[model samples]
Target: MTHATAPSPDAPLEASATIDGAEWWRSAVIYQIYPRSFADANGDGMGDLAGITSRLDALKQLGIDAIWLSPFFASPQKDAGYDVSDYCAVDPLFGTLEDFDTMADAAHARGIRVIVDLVPNNSSDQHEWFQEALAAAPGSPERARYIFRDGRGEHGEEAPNNWDSVFGGPAWTRTANADGSPDQWYLHLFDSSQPDFDWSNADVRRMFRDVLRFWLDRGVDGFRVDVAHGLVKADGLPDFTPPVGAGSMGGQAADEEPVTAPYWGQEGVHEIYREWNQVLAEYDGQRVLCAEAWVDPLEKMALWVRSDEMQQAFNFPYLETPWNGPALRTIIDKSLAAFSSVGAPSTWVLSNHDVVRHASRLALTAENPQGHGIGPETGDRPDRELGLRRARAASALMLALPGGAYIYQGEELGLPEAIDLPDEARQDPTWFRTSGERYGRDGCRVPIPWEADAPAYGFSETGASWLPQPEDWGPYARASQRGDADSTLELYSRALWLRSTHQLGLGAIEWHDAGDDSILWFSNGPITVVANTGVTDAVVPTPLRDATRILASSPHDEGALPADTTAWFLTP
Candidate 1:
């Protein structure tokens, strides 16, 4: 059930005697960089590899251990670079391979590891393989790399089955036969422009393995596997309805925990990773693989990170879980127990490019779970005061947990979702395919503000934001909050610094007052964390009363914490 080699105290990358590099990911704080929205260079109004290289100083100052860059692979940009046409080349819009090397060089120079996004489940329809598949006749070798099937109807106009695209509409797109009649259908779980690859094909398997090597040789520290749970489909491609309450984030959430889906979690997927693990083992940088899976039940998610599989998996359930004290505590405990069973550390996350900014989503409950779905009226609004306050408290608690953490760009600045972007400015295909029913992820992808009053909030020297920025963004710009003691950015920087230097990520967590239900109290070695989720102020518990109050999410004098606050204490 568990096979990973246990980490030793003397392992590499250890910040001190407390944390080790052998399992650096266990305590590492990784920052997710959506290249397009991170920073702009070349006056193209688009963030590029060069821009990322230029900003390594900012990232180093943030106290993060690594950067997870979203895809910059050669692509049609139909799905904002997710539809990759070439696995080895960089998109011209984001600069060339040399720029990526410069970025990687700069990152490694500052002790920051670089992890690139890898989309192996699908490729752009314009890919050479797909183009050859199109030119070749039916049942040809060229078509074997993709999931192409014969249509069922008389005119062969009908899709192969009832599977629907995650974006909306039919998953199967009928392609014209050699005679110009719609005959063969290809599967695309996302936009039609992205054709799903057939993992069963030997060529597909060998090709991706080579892709991994191409980047590994380029000094990449690791990869964030896209659609990590989506390569293997069910046998026969039978039809089934997705249970209600399925997840809307990237991949489908289970109808229930430990979900059973024909499309996700096929046994073959693990074997693929086993092979990948072997590839990573050949590299020497303590290189790792992290899954962007939407799997459910913390235990189910752990399968992706088995001893010989990936090293980390996105904690979507924790991200989707509500802000209630009990719920948060339960998920955290469950995640710890699950990952521990596999000899891997659990990861904590609150926001990413695909989801709404937690600072704004914290105010949402089950009844109002719409994340960044803006309408003409009352849609682009959340109680900012309440949401931002809770988000701050949660961050303190999140960083103190006994494992790794991921920080979404702009989140450290308390940026809210750019919900009011006009329809024309929205870029996610989910918006166009769903006919606007789903506002898509553009709100969260808005370029981050770097200066309080500069043009384009200092994101672009040309004042040309690819996606328009809201006027309010100026207040949360990096320049405005950089050194403010109580600012979200400072809170995050201090939290990460403490998490690493104190060995908090290495020890076990002892719950202090979990039974109280309205509060979460726990201790990790010398670092202690407490959060008050109740309406009224919670008295500092007895054991912590004598401890040293090192920091707090909200402004407060020593020992006095207001409601909706999370505080850190150093136990003697």
Candidate 2:
């Protein structure tokens, strides 16, 4: 856990250096690909590995540095591949092991590094281990791999604890024995179909260790550790009492202490990552481990990325921050400072497969803005134009910051949540677990648009997308945006290009004096990024008002930055 003290923002980062030509991820612009919705090659109405391999060229052309792939491991698809049935094999729903190898080779050929999801916290109910655990007598070794315990009530009738599932309902589910009697209760922080592992067990630790080596040896570049902070529960399966009310994304309310959460950010989790760091160091590619921790107080989140643990952790607070100037600045400054405490680089993310797409969520000026668990209103349509404008601006501002960034699959196309899907078509476990009161994240999981008019919007050759695509998506299709200068896709491409060729991601960002609450202006070296989230047009501030205009989220003509616009400039 030892490293040199963090250098000042102006100094080059030691972690950003090349180790046998593997310094790409330090300031890399990584893209997240949700397999089932990215594209479908065999026309099974779902995206697969072969389809992903075929589209590597498009991603390469997108000017990104790497790809962070969600799970495609063997599974029952109960959690869409997160509930892994077999850690070493590919799920047929996606493709075979050969398909994964081909996809890896193709991605490398295009200079794009591959980082797959690692779900060490849980396994599908259908997995051989879980199946054996289900059939074995209580207190057997098979049951030890999972977190199985006898129920607490008389006659073992009730669940072991009162903890709630992240999806919904009780966290513990009872298992029946051959005698038709309730045997034991197993813990699943998410769905009952995905049983949580007992990290304290030696076997569980060894199994995940082997799984990590299996992927690392497969020529993949890294892993995005799913539920990275939830590996080890508190000493006892304690009742999680939030200081105030309940919450998700680490399940802490605004005023709740982050590190004290019962099921997350435990001290034991670091030992797991410290060992994982050794395994990553053995590989040649500077194979990284990125945590999907949602812990807050930024300093607590920093624990996961200390020199010996994970290389990076997602900056969820930044992703969830509102599009206000002072609010965003506070989160940004705190995030940078926190990560610096550990001598690690902070990773910025906008939207991912698990949340509502930022394009639409940022446009919500009404109730429940995070778009978590809320379905679309019966007769309301989100402000598509407004959301896209802000998303574009946010993208520029994110890329201009000093660290790595992640782009969800369709962010570049200005895609919003597919809110109009019929209730019957929804598939998130949270929806069913909550009895339809919670919509879950299916809205953000819709298949992406590639061709403007092709069948299923070019998601599948058979014109069948696993999740329905909206009709309005045609205008934002890749075909329509590829050469269009004003398209969000191209705007992202240009921003990434500037980011890659310059020292923007490695340098400090100093605040620019715009003197307006609605606008955020910041300078990185000689380049400046100004974002106006207000409702009125804004004049660029100060002596550089007439500086050379470069890239913009929306068009800037005659020296005026329109509302919800972001523009890049050269500080003359």
TM-score of model number 1: 0.94
For model 2, residues 1-572, the per-residue Cα lDDT tens digits are 11112122222212223435335666788899999999899999999999999888788777787899899998888888889999999888998999999999989877789999999889999989999999898888999899998888788888877888888788899988788877889999999999999898998999888988898888989999999989898877777655554356474555556546778878899999999999889888578889998786788899998888888899988988888888898899999999988888878999998887889878877534232534666234568888888899888889999888999999999998888888988889988898887788899999999998899888898998878788788998898888677788878877776676566767788886688878898888778888998889988776656677667888766578889888788774
Question: Candidate 1's residue-wise lDDT over 333-414, tens digit each?
Answer: 8999999999899998999887778887887553333233543444446778888999999888888887888999998888
Off by over 4 Å in 2: 1-22, 243-246, 255-259, 367-374, 378-381
Q: Candidate 2, TM-score vs. the true structure?
A: 0.94
